[model samples]
Target: MRVILALLLMAGMARAGSDRPGDFDYYVMALSWSPSWCALEGDARGAAQCDPRRGHGFVLHGLWPQHETGWPAWCDSDARAPSRSEIRAMVPIMGSAGLVRYQWEKHGRCSGLAAGAYFDAARRAWTRVRRPAALRQPDRPARLAPAEVERAFLAANPGWTADMVTITCKNGHIQEARICLTKDLAPRPCGADVVRDCRARAARMPPVR
Candidate 1:
């Protein structure tokens, strides 16, 4: 039931240029992963690869690259993480098959995931030529709220555990791009500014022990 979302390129930490509207096919919901879990196949673009590919959690983000055409891309955060219970809540109400169906039914009519755009072999990346109005707005990264991020994190993982979070963005199987988190959000880089923000958030959050 797990499929590696191709849109993950948006989550890449490599360097890339900017993308215009309609440049990409759509934002993607990456398979369960933290920034560090990502992996690169070869030395092609100096990509990083994660070992023991762990994706055992519910979906948490909808990352999109700043650009789709040039080099390393910037990732714009989309949907805040959804609580595991919230997604599963619909299971009984919607049925396992019906849950996914209900999701598509409620959002697919205007969703981008259903658009079926593509990543050409020559371009070696994803591009969007067709899209639904819903995808245009709802899934847009600009709409995400800080509270939503916290709430979603709380839901999916009643006790979400992450010592750190690193971010990365990629172009197909090519280029590597890194997304920079805010001052309040925990970043993955050792000396990266994210460390400061993560420490701050940790200070505010309830003690885990």
Candidate 2:
């Protein structure tokens, strides 16, 4: 009986962090710099978003549900996956169908929203934040401090403060601008983990093709 009780307690402990759909405190909208991404990785993958004709700048990365601390992911949900048409429609903003599907499987599932609603919510959140014009179409590569990038975003969007936005870097390139928002999509202060601003003194910002 003691052995059985021990096993049951172990099972309960294992389930403590199990992701449940729609059970998070807020959201984080991640916007990627297209040129920086292409320079670092997308070119190797022959990603269409890297095409010079596309002229993509800041593109939607994902809208992730967050907790005050550690976040949930890959929650099992009865909600159907996005239809092919739905996935394709997001390509202009999200960059690829694979990303659309992958995000749904990972962060989107944890949102507790069905695939369509989740994508729609993501779109709504994306549209709400204005991209900085200076970073949108630079004709030449420039090195900028992460704080400068964050300031550009803060300037473009009123009502957003320093605590609500963060800049992240990868391989010496400015990667993405992440913003914290309430569940309803209003700007909010980021959690401790989400406030990890990139420490790069002058990360490269590749020019838009």
Model 1 TM-score relative to the real fold? 0.19
For residues 3-103, write the lDDT of model 1, one tens digit per residue. 34545553443234333223332232222222222323222433222212321112232233222223223223243333454445433322233333333
TM-scores, in order shown?
A: 0.19, 0.90
lDDT measured at residue 104 in model 2 versus the true structure, 0 to 100: 89
- Candidate 2 residue-wise lDDT, 1-209, digit = tens: 99999999765543345478988888999999989999988999998888999998899999988878767777878889899988987899988788888988989989998888888999999988988888888999899999999999999998888999999999999999999999999999998878999998999999988
Best candidate, lDDT = 2
Model 1 collision count: 29
Error of 2 at 180 (Å): 0.4
Worst 10 residues of 2 by lDDT: 9-18
What C-alpha lDDT values do all the predictions have?
0.26, 0.89
